[model samples]
Target: MSEKLKVGITIGDVNGIGLEVIIKTLANNRILDFFTPIVYGNTKVASFHRKAIGITDFSFNVINSADQASEKRPNMINCWHEDVKIMLGESNSIGGKYAFLSLEKATDDLIQGKIDVLITAPINKHNIQQDEFNFPGHTEYIQSKTGSKDALMFMISEELKIGVVTGHIPVKEIAENITKETILAKLRLMHNSLKNDFWVQKPKIAVLGLNPHAGDNGLIGSEDQDIVIPAIEEANEMDVFAFGPYPADGFFASDNYKNFDGVLAMYHDQGLIPFKQLAFHNGVNFTAGLPVIRTSPDHGTGYDIAGKNIASEQSFKEAIFAAVHIAKRRKEQDDLLANPLKIRKLTKDRD
Candidate 1:
């Protein structure tokens, strides 16, 4: 209770708008009251990004480790000390190389319990692939790092919460990947996250149909009727109120997503396309079902607007706050679990 939550952050691609948005977010000292930020990136890169963004006053408190982070100011740890070329708005191997270094260091600190939560900046998915980091995206990478069995790409905002059964896979691979077991696993993950992290007492989840019009009741395709439907039926028995193999088109068009506590789409773009359209600037990409807390901005490496100071830091800021909130919720849940009899006694007395 004496210390603020420690947030470990990764500067995505040096060539992108990662550092720009991170600097902007940390510049606002008001957020320091909520959590202490420990950025795993070089001080030189941060300075370069700051100068390019035309910010003059803000500075990072250089620290050797996340444990030395100051609660009153934003902190930085140099993942790389060498002077890397700053080629803003360009995607190259250099960007990817350093991005991995920052991410790896932050992830180590996160897994080792030096930081309470992690907020990652956007990384170039293509260039940031090598022997050590050869995953589809951060969701899979973090899943592997933390040794979590399943990880759901949960896109969250004030109103909307959507998770996908299949993420960062090609369209052709989607149909084959969608199975009853996968859908059921995602349903269980989202349900538990809603209850424990978001504090939803009894979550009602909406499951979107894979094929058109839910396979037009077996007209278009039988995947929805055969796989998705069975998954929802089984989810009900598992204490998850999952319903609907509803037509994805009409579901978002009619604003039907508002009626449920959470929505589970069959694939990535199916859920994220609509979620981004609704809350692009503020949506937080949460990797649910992991033992550790992690979140990121809904947007990606903004090479198009890098160093222009035009990119909005809203989504990155939202991700930081979301991670902090979820950490607090999980801690409370842990305390309750540790003393179930006391919780029950208090509830009984109140009733």
Candidate 2:
């Protein structure tokens, strides 16, 4: 508790509004109370943004590594060069290359334990893809880097958090791809994340049906009655609170989701649609089951309004806070596991 948590952040797509939101969020002095943020990006672009916004009090120090950064002042840990000197709203291949490099730097620092957590801004998916780098998004990139196969992507707000059984795959392919091993792994990952990252002692999870009306008990489809039901049975034996194959069309009809800690969507849009419907303004995209804490804003690069400065910093700020909160919980849990008696005294009386 004596030292501040070092949060390494990636400023994505300098041509987009990533820098704008990062500047706006960290400028608030209250953030210093929670984290010592080390921003991984270009120094020149950050300086240009500082001048454009007419802010003089904020200054960024360049560092080669996270340890070089001091908690006393916010730092811009320079990782790459600004590819092009382009306007804010314009798109360029140079900008994409720079953005990808910043993420690579941050990922390296994270793996080395030089930083406690990773918070990323939005990146242009199309612009950043090159012949050498062919990732669909940040989740896949992190998964490949960490060599983790059981990772799940969850979009979170205070009110709702939805994890995807399948993400970024074609809609037509989802049905064929849904399998028991995949569903079981997703459930276990979500359960462990809630317990370890969120400090939920007994996490409850809901599973959504792949077909309408839960396949009407196999009239419409047999996946819910066969695959999903068997998975839930296996989960029950493990003592994980998992229930469903709930009807996709009617799962959110009432307050059905409120009773569970997290929900597993059949596919991407099935879960994201409701989550964004409720918490788009301040939602966070969290990568569950990573060896380290990772989070980002739930939105994407707004190339249309990249320069207007109207991009809401709310989700970015929320992502930063979520990363901090999860990191703190993970630290606390680790400390408790290292010393069981301390945790017992701290939590035992909650009956």
Candidate 3:
């Protein structure tokens, strides 16, 4: 029998519901059959959250490193041994400090190939800011860490898959960022991600316009016609099977997004708002164009219900499963490529 894949998890803002959801998800012992879970967090922190959630039976196999992780039981690595205060439902500096520590440790292991995949919990983006981790979000941080030329914030679910052109940016700057070159570059990333990562052959991508009613042919704005349209045309010339500067409003409202394999929005909210509304609990935020596989729950830190035990673990669980599934598919694809089967023709003489 083959060994289980080591799924590394980073505990996001300790003050929030990061540990809560993680405990709830792994509480189901059956999940252990799929992959070996290695959590990068303190055992004391895990115990505190578990007790707060009233889950007394749950425990972790505490280890100092991933090599010591247990396949049958969930394992945890103590990123920090010092006793830290737990302020549930609040965003404090300590929470941010530990969050970065956990993330930094897990990512270091990921880059070194210690783990097969990484699933991060929610983080308070503002509070987690520091000199070493001064990025807009996890996508950019991981992109820089892995030295990936570009990274796509690929929001995925069973129903829809969306990618943003300009991620983690202000809405006012969206227009200026929507240039022909930028759109084409994002389209190329999405196109390649769909083909290579998701195993979709010849994916058909729908590009949404930057303005209302797709700029109404220069009525509301000219970006759709001037920038997005030409970028799509050039993408088609490159054999990307790209289409549209479709009006964002009616496109999703009228269910027109179902026709394409992927949708490329002009900015972050343009893509995520609709996606979250549709698949909030089940959606997985996959960071595409990275050398390593990374995913996170679609939702953020449930600060309102941090320790109330009301937070849902469905999305986090799905994120883990998605990571496992993608890793397996990628491995299979690599294996096939390494030892490709040769086709043999039968002729009359041979028969």
Candidate 4:
């Protein structure tokens, strides 16, 4: 419809496989056909990665600013500072600072609308902390930077899409975190994200219980009965199609999960264990309810496999493709909304 949407990518934890995945994913010509990708990291690091991986066809056109980035072509669009000399698979304060700086640069471009969507690679959580940067992960950092309270992390695949009610927090804090207000907020974000960002109309979502067997009717724990159920009831009363208090143990084992469009887990591991098991190579970690689109590979910075040139780029490729599809669908929906008659006729044809 229009020229490809420009996607700004931040190389996460340059010591890890972030650069490798970007190199491998961009090597495919079909990616250029969908969106013009711009990488916001050190051009030197990317060049080193390309050489180490034996990829020679690709090249990055370094630019001083996002405005200088060519919308007509796929460019690396260097946002390089220092730390370009850091060794791979090793963590240092310099690497940590630049990793965070890359994210900040991408955020500025995102807010300015120079990039339609932002896709981040994995960054080391521990190393990312500097004197000024205190956020735990990308999700929290984005939420804080954008002042968005409802932002949540969602891991998606063709079969299963899971969202965490509480993320990047300790297990002891999860039960205390479960509340009617929090669950309702997350549910609304998930619903809006499905309808608007993902283009899913009337999306059905399932909620998982915090305790085993959903607190076994309160014998095992009261959080599921007192916290999760009431939140679900309130959401249902609001006409949201949410059903569950399912035990994390057997939810993925049964066919029950196949009926819903997405699953809302109580916390991180409760959701990720099954998601990684099913779609580790191709799963995408998407942050929902952001003003801008954002996605990353479901996996993290594999320090052990960092410069091996063997890390599979499947998930990164899937993330980029998903971003492109969602961005296109959102634009199309906006156009259709602008033309009501066409939308009505399409609805009539479907009926």
Which clashing pairs does model 4 show? none
Q: Which stretches of candidate 2 lie over 4 Å from their true place?
A: 51-57
TM-score result, candidate 3: 0.96
Give the Å shift of residue 270 in candidate 1: 0.4
TM-score of 4: 0.95
| Stretches of candidate 3 exceeding 4 Å from the true structure | 1-3, 342-351
Expressed as tens digits, the lDDT of each residue in 75-131 for candidate 1 is: 999988889998999999999999999999999999999999999999999999999
User: Which window of ten consecutive residues has the lowest lDDT sum in model 1?
Assistant: 1-10
TM-score of each candidate structure, all chains considered together: 0.98, 0.95, 0.96, 0.95
For model 2, the run of ten residues with the poorest summed lDDT: 80-89
Regarding lDDT, does 2 or 4 come out ahead? 2
Candidate 3 vs 4: which has more lDDT: 3
lDDT of 4 by residue, 121-154 (tens): 9998898997657877898888777878679799
> Better model by lDDT, 1 or 4?
1
For each candidate in the order shown, give its overall lDDT on alpha carbons: 0.94, 0.86, 0.91, 0.84
Residue by residue across 202-224, what tens digits does model 3's lDDT show? Answer: 89999998888999989998888
- The order of the candidates by TM-score, greatest first, is 1, 3, 4, 2
What is the lDDT, from 0 to 100, of the residue 188 in candidate 4? 83
Which runs of model 4 end up more than 4 angstroms from their true locations? 71-73, 81-83
